[model samples]
Target: MLSIIVALLVNLLIETSVSFSVVVPGDPVVAHVGSTVILPCWINPPENAEALEIRWYRKEFSNTFLHYKPGKVPDMPVEPYRNRTSLTPRSDQSGGLKDGDVSLRLEKLRVQDEGSFRCYVSGESSYDSEEVDLKVTALGSTPVLFLKFLDDGRVNISCKSSGWHPKPSVTWMSDERRVLHPGGVFYSREAHEMFSVHSWTAVSRSDAQLVSCSLSLKTGELKDGRMDIQGIVSSDSSGPWKALFFTLFIFALLGFGLVGFFLYKCRPGKKPDKEIVGDVNIEEPRKHAVEITVDREHLHPDLMVTKNCKIMRDGPGYDHTGEGFPYELCAFGAQRFTSGRHYWEVKLTQENTPPKNYWLIGVVKHGNFTVRDRSALTPSSGYWFLCSDGPNGFHTNTDPPVKLSLTPRPERLGVLLDYEEGQLSFYNIKESKHLLTISTRFSGTVVPLFNPGAGDQSPLIILDCTKPVKSAEESSQPLLSNNSSNA
Candidate 1:
């Protein structure tokens, strides 16, 4: 009887000595925006955790990001994490909890997603928790330089870049390697918590030649852009004006000779059937081109915009409604138009293996526009869309919807809106063929809208058509109004 009691007591002691603890990564996990990363957390001894309750939450929040109660399904995660957070399986054949792996797989990481997360595991008799830190970074676009003439005979050089996380440092330098002190600096934070910066400096015309702008981060990522201002100034006190005059004289003689030849070709009976104007043979569409940039603040959470605001693509995770539109990947233009003619182009590519199955591009009114309902896309509802579906082909979003028959589908689409004329037209820029036109009276302000559609990896790019004019006469030529309102 004494030996039996002693053996039972030893067994009890063995059972009591079994330990329960949590293991987490010693270092913080670093991930880029629009990428997937794993936050590791697991039971130290590798026991079956399938029956244990597992909960993951942000260290600063009470709302759980993920919660699993043994045999029951997980509860809904917080808004920002919906459809973006999941648990990795410990093995291919068994559920993750069975092997004590509670690692969280987060997709389409955003700048605001950086922080510490707590993973809690609870069993019938033991409970343990661990904290893991995640850091998110975004590389910004290449810097761009803009030049403006100031009233004091100096030029204002502005350098701009977007889509950086934790901000970045910008510098201006002259061709002679002199560092410049920027007059002003500005920063804006996007909805994703990334940043955009603009810095400006005033320099004399002589010092403006070959100005360079550079943006850099602590991680050794750097981008540089340069602008040549020599052409902007005709001559400086130390420059050779006589040589410039001689060059102009030679060009003038050549221009006169070309004009004479053109006149000789059109002389009386020798006139050709088609008239030639300048170097172009065809009458191009009225040039009303505008530079379009995506509005980051209004972008869908599951959509990623390039630092330049020109390219937009569907993010990695499945789509879920945290706020605003529920099932669509949408972004708006940064500029809005209330009047006058405006035109912009979007380029699509077949480089994506299967190509994108669905896309929508057009304009939408500013107020009371709900992107929540895909069916509400119509002119009456303040939306004018030219949509394409893989199976359904192309169509316009009208009251009854109009099916479009287009041969050799367009890869580059040009949208022309004439607010005063009550006209909206679509064109295949590659073929220079007009596709469709809708006549509708628009009121108030309207901004460009873009949707790349779900499951499509292809990005929609806004093409920049603005270029520097060579002569003052060309620069002064009357073109479409370039004024725009903030989107």
Candidate 2:
């Protein structure tokens, strides 16, 4: 009887030790907004967890995000995590549950997703819980600088950017490195829970030289944009030139030959007609055709790009594992533009396919292609795109996505970039219909980007359009006019 009692006690001790020892990651898990991250939890000593119950919930609110049992299907997640959360096994073999892995996978991480989570496991007579902290980070767009002449004679220097979480800070400084306070600031929250900020500082003519604008996050990410105010000559400095031009104009008007010349130059009904082609009315300043090829080095892992960098398709073996984070099936063009006007086209090659379920075409700052977060693909992040998704339809990838009404989607799309004018326009090449235009000051070199969403086997083919040639008379004309008024 004594030996039997001793053996029973030993068996109970071993079973208790094996069932109740739960382990979780000691350090906090860090992830970016719109990214998927894993919160690791497992049974110590590697005992099978297939028959146990696992629950992951917010430590503060006790709101469950995931709950799983061995034999029955997991319970429906709460409102916030309806379809965006999942459980991952610890081992690739035995389906992970048998290996005691109970890690929780969170998809499309949001700003509110940052906090402590509790992983609770329970068995017949053993129960244990561990806490895991999740931290979500948001990276906003590159700062853009704008200089506008105010009606009161002060120069309004403004900076704007979008696509940030946990709103960031904006600062303006003069060439002397003195901080300038903003006269006004504006912030807007986007559909994806990101932020856009526009801040302006009014400065006197004397202080217009080199002004800088910076955007920063608490995580230490910073982007700066600077403008040379000297290039924007003050209205006061051009007063003498304007007066001289006025006197010369008065003298010239006194001559009969000058009067005839002026009448010819200013003919009321003789305005030059702009060129119109197909369905497009070409009102642009100068159209220069550019050849663009894909940049394979920056392409996402799930994209299969052709050697010539003209075609792209989804990788056959790419898997999403059902997590709802936006998959990055994008590639960047090799060409970079900083000045002048350029036009390029992309044609969809697949036939008999419903309009692509997802597609994106736009320009991004040279290095921004590597950012995996979808929020980083906003205008504020140095990215401007026209995107079409199955649910969202067609829209400009702005802070507040601007929905487009495109009838008979064009298979061929045209992109026009006017660097000097701070304009990016899109057109339906096949239909010759104008789609949309984005106006924003660009601070640095930008490259073309294409994201043919996952599973989209259709290729995006780059087309070669003929460049417009200028006639000898048009080419010889002075590009700048000395008689232009400064005001």
lDDT of each: 0.71, 0.71
Of candidate 1, the 10-residue stretch with the lowest lDDT total is: 473-482
Give the per-residue lDDT of model 2 (tens digit) for 1-487: 9999999999999966655688987888888898988888888777788888888888653677788887898888998999898888634563477788888888888988888989888988788889989878788877777676677877887788767776888888988999998888788665456777778898886667888888888778887889888677544578777767545443332223344345445647765331111245533422577888876666676766655566666666678553433437777888998898888877764555655656788888776655455655667557888877655667776645666546676677888888997878787765665666676788679988887666554556666565533223122222221111111
lDDT by residue (tens digit), candidate 1, 384-462: 8788776667767764466666666677777888899777877776676666666678977899988876555456667
Relative to the true structure, candidate 2 reaches a TM of: 0.47
Q: Over all chains combined, what TM-score does candidate 1 have?
A: 0.49
Could you tell me how far off, in angstroms, the CA of residue 403 lies in candidate 2 after the best superposition?
Answer: 27
Candidate 2: stretches off by over 4 Å: 1-28, 44-46, 59-65, 72-83, 89-99, 150-154, 175-177, 234-271, 274-487
Candidate 1 clashes between residue pairs 3 or more apart in a chain or in different chains:
none
